[model samples]
Target chain A: MSDEDFQEPEVLLPLDAWHRAHGARMVPFAGYSMPIQYEGIIAEHLWTRESAGLFDVSHMGQLLVSGEGADAALEALLPGDIKGLREGRMRYSLLLSDEGGILDDLMVTRRADDFYLVVNGATKIDDIAHIHEHLPEELTLNHMDEQALLALQGPKAVDALARLVPGVEALSFMTAGAFAIAGVPAWISRSGYTGEDGFEISIPAEAAEQVATLLADQPEVKPIGLGARDSLRLEAGLPLYGHDLDPETTPISADLGFAISKRRREEGGFPGAQRILAERAAGSAFKRVGLIIEGRQPVREGAVVQPDGKITSGGFSPSLQKPIAMAYVPAVSAVPGSTIAIEQRGKIFTGTVTPMPFLPHRYHRQGSSK
Target chain B: MSLYFTKDHEWISVEGTSATVGITDYAQSQLGDVVFVEVPAAGTAVEKGKEAAVVESVKAASDVYAPVSGEVIEGNAALEADPALVNTAPEGEGWFFKLTLSNPSELDGLMDADAYKTFVDGL
Candidate 1:
């Protein structure tokens, strides 16, 4: 076959034209033509930390699962306590393979009638297929492809969004509610990938441009691209699916044991429950840890940490103004104070194991001091 | 002094046998904000079309290939403390390294200022 035949055409997001008109640098990500940056990554990142940044996350997969035993069926595939999730509550979860490896990391929200799931864009197809194969025949799995997702993140997000959608401020972090933005129906979740006070809005694809334009028109809001979204999440110490968590990584190894709910950990009915339970008890051989590099040179993914560790997600932290990374190291070297040497391009760089979020998460949880 | 360019976006300002090298303005613009730069040390030998330095932006790291074979005399120290210089004044103060050209004849293979502009425009 010719090279042209071998190439996969990129899928365009609902905001493709909007992003281009706003000076976004388009890059192919997760099979979609997504905006990597606008103005610049650092500027966008800092702006989001200070004010509000609107992100086009339409590439992510929105799914709805409903049936007589939907909660139980989902629990069998995920390690979270799906059955116990109250309406409007959201939980971080991991889709586990039969061997305890992670298929994807996702957010699950219990809506009034069905469970709303947001899976990583890159792994959604496989996630849907896996869910279909294992879920009982009675359950209905619906892929909400016509929904466009947007995240309005950072400190000023609440002020900006609550003005448009008055009741949004009432929804605390990890909670969702149906709302309207300028008469367009939306499912707004007080949650986001960035460890900031934020909201993730799900709206109709056809109405995306209108909603996005309205949000951007807000004084505190600016259009942010995937590049800043990445750095912000990195500083927040949130793991990116393909980078930090993958098919070979387990929740225990990824330092995401919190995703396995207390009930699920005890009942042990989920996929790879036997192995995950064992790892939880005995400890995994390798553990994910955060590293703060000593110098200006940023260590990137694939850099080797001395004595058999590897950086999975590494980059310059715009917030900290330093280089930080997440790496898998032996349990012995995973402590916050431990010093580690990383080798990249024939040079060794020193780093300290730091407790992450490299910068503290400023999530606006209920009853928390602002 | 004469200026020349390579398709890889490197520019060399040749003065006698001593030359200063840096990425072109177009190159720096394409790279966005440079967070870090790793240039070669003095006395190191660099081959034409070979990787001699690394320029890292917020997103990723890219190799800055040597435009011509040379013996490095100095790597820019300003970049050590402030790599953003590459974005602000790429050609003027953001020069990555100074080197003594081993083969001035190799300059024949590079593009002049106008030609480089056309080359970049074609890209």
Candidate 2:
């Protein structure tokens, strides 16, 4: 019953005391004691969709990759267009095995001097080991363990954060830059996992509480927890590394072909490019698809997808007011409008294979946020 | 008629042989924003401390257990359409089912209202 990774005892983040003081219901997750909910998941989720929701995601791995040929070294280990990543822009990419299966998904930013990588918390150690083994000898990878990460996300996020850190509104979606928040030095990216207009701030551990308290005091910001973070990302149709994605899953099968940049597809030297690009050209055996459950009852993860595999992730979607899920099914059964049957707890629940992002993304671009 | 409590946080109001069963308000508050409820069909037999229903929130799913052995005569069909009843009125309109008690003596093993309050407080 303990789903914990057990790699180590539960650890606390820099914001642990801060979360505890704010009535967070802490749960052990990915080897850290994390807040699963404060007021409630549904309320916080809805709040993010309307206003700004602050999230403490310091558990994710933050690294600085530098030295000559770091971009090419990273390209050899990943499928992203790293060499071409312009300064201050961030790209979502996947770390892949030689066979083209996903090692992990990550966000790689091209800073002025080096690359800034943010990877999943649970797989951070393994990711570091993998990178160290494969990265060129000239490159150096440093784990920025002394930093804490926070995401201020939603429609009102921009205005509220702009008040504290001037000129942050100038950055567009998927952009990264340095900013001073309440006079605290921080690295901020105009990006987030919630598919809303937001900013991800990386600040020193010592200044985390002060910076977090400043943001929390904002009229538009309410402290959100991992529970709402999951639901919010689910509505955005993003996959969690340990759940919807894993080592056994390939980028094509995971519907992450976008990470395989255009130039990489043509250049064809990245890890598992042969197998991955082939699967892309001639579809994978199974595909990750979204589901719309027929009724009120939820069909959770591990439910058998009739004539195929299992539901990788599922739950009630507060945004849609119905059950939504992501699952792997045979390529033949992956059509957008096709209805599939899932059996859980001795009963069958009807679900339609709908296109992902059950809700529309409201990202802020340089031109428009609406 | 008397209300008895189960360790699993269920309450059963016994009137002669028929008992009304539902979760305590505390359980619903902990569950938060109940989106759906799945109850055992009427006419099914359930044993004490056995799974009888499931309540799901956006965050997680929990199994609601039967507090006493009985034949289920009715399920709260209203919950099928409005699961938030569990959060709004956990002990009243949110009642999960009605069952005819098979062993009336099982009620003695449960706590009284005051004891149930103390038990919940400990948690």
Candidate 3:
């Protein structure tokens, strides 16, 4: 066969037609033809910050693990305290290699009968194989390929979602519940990547279009694409899987130590526990720090930081209207006010280390005043 | 003044030996919202078909190639304050730079307005 014939075809999402009908610009991403933008990235970004935006993130991998001792089995691989996670609660965790490198980051939710995990789309296949190899034969892992995910995020997200699924207003951050939207069964969690009040709804793939349309019909809701999603998350200081977090990086170096629960820290039973705990006590050689660029031109990923560091994720922040980036720098120079120099495309750029979430997070936590 | 365009979507308006260059409307629209622009300063020499300016959108950056060899006379300083002009008026106030042509005959190899429109249509 010719080289062209050997090329793999791009996969289509369940809401492909819906995105096109809304004027989305489709681009190949993560082996799938996904919508990169509609109207324009800047316009959609600002709209989401001001009101509510509906995003189709069905490309994520959803899995259900159940059977006897499932929580204990999972705790062996992940550093988070899984066994202590109560029903209807969620916690972020990392899948670490035996050498203590981060394989993937995921959200684990304990349901009444099983544990539901949401992993990155690009690493789903490898993650599944690794889990199967490590988990005992008694546990059953089911891949929910037929399910579609949607996220409604922003200041007015609760208002728009509550109108469609009543009683969703009661769900606090990191909480999940079984709900029905337009008579379709759904599993919804009060969580999202954007630093805003939001919810992630998972429903059957066949009902994706129906659910998406009903939400878009809301006065405050607009159909957003991946372009806006990237800018939103960057402003929130959230790290991406492939760019910011990778197998070469550890949770301690990536500034994700919060995911390691206190119980797991003392027990030292999880993978890479030895290396991770030591890093926590002595500090890692390199630390991830957020930088605010000094000029208009953005220093994107792959930019070199002077001495011994590299930018992992960098982009223009729509909210701050400035260039913000995340880079790994020597632990001694990682102070919030330290200055750093970066080189990109043969040009030198100056950046100041700043605390992340360039814009303060607005998550609707329980008992938090708006 | 006669207008000529390159296959790269750059348009140059020539008057005697002086010329002004900018990207076409189609180019700006394809780039989406413009956030930053970088142009050659005065007294800088440029080669034909080489990168002369840069235009960045919210998603990515693109290079604007020179249509003909010349020496830059002035860059659009207005863009420093408001780069959105590239999207709002790509052919007018959004002109990237003004240059003195080294070889005026080079313009003859470029496409006319109607030809550029047809080329863009075929794309």
Docking class of 2: medium
- In order, the Cα lDDT scores of the candidates are 0.92, 0.91, 0.91
Question: Backbone collision count in every prediction?
Answer: 0, 0, 0
| lDDT for A303 (candidate 1) | 97
| Model 3 residue-pair collision total | 0
Please state the error at residue B92 of candidate 2 in Å.
2.0
lDDT of each residue in B16-64, candidate 3, tens digit only: 9999999999888778888889999999999999889988788777788
Q: How close is candidate 3 to the true structure, as a TM-score?
A: 0.96
TM-score of chain A of each: 0.97, 0.97, 0.97
Candidate 2 has an lDDT of 0.91
Ranking by DockQ: 2, 1, 3
Candidate of highest DockQ:
2
lDDT of 1 by residue, A174-267 (tens): 9999999999999999999888899999999999999999999999999998989999998889999999999899999999999999999989
> Model 2: per-residue lDDT, tens digit, B1-123?
899988788899999999999998888877778999888888999898889888888877888888899999999999988999998999999999999999999888999999999998976
Give the clashing pairs for model 3: none
Q: Each candidate's TM vs. the true structure?
A: 0.97, 0.96, 0.96
Pick the winner on DockQ between candidates 1 and 3: 1
Q: Which candidate number maximizes TM-score?
A: 1
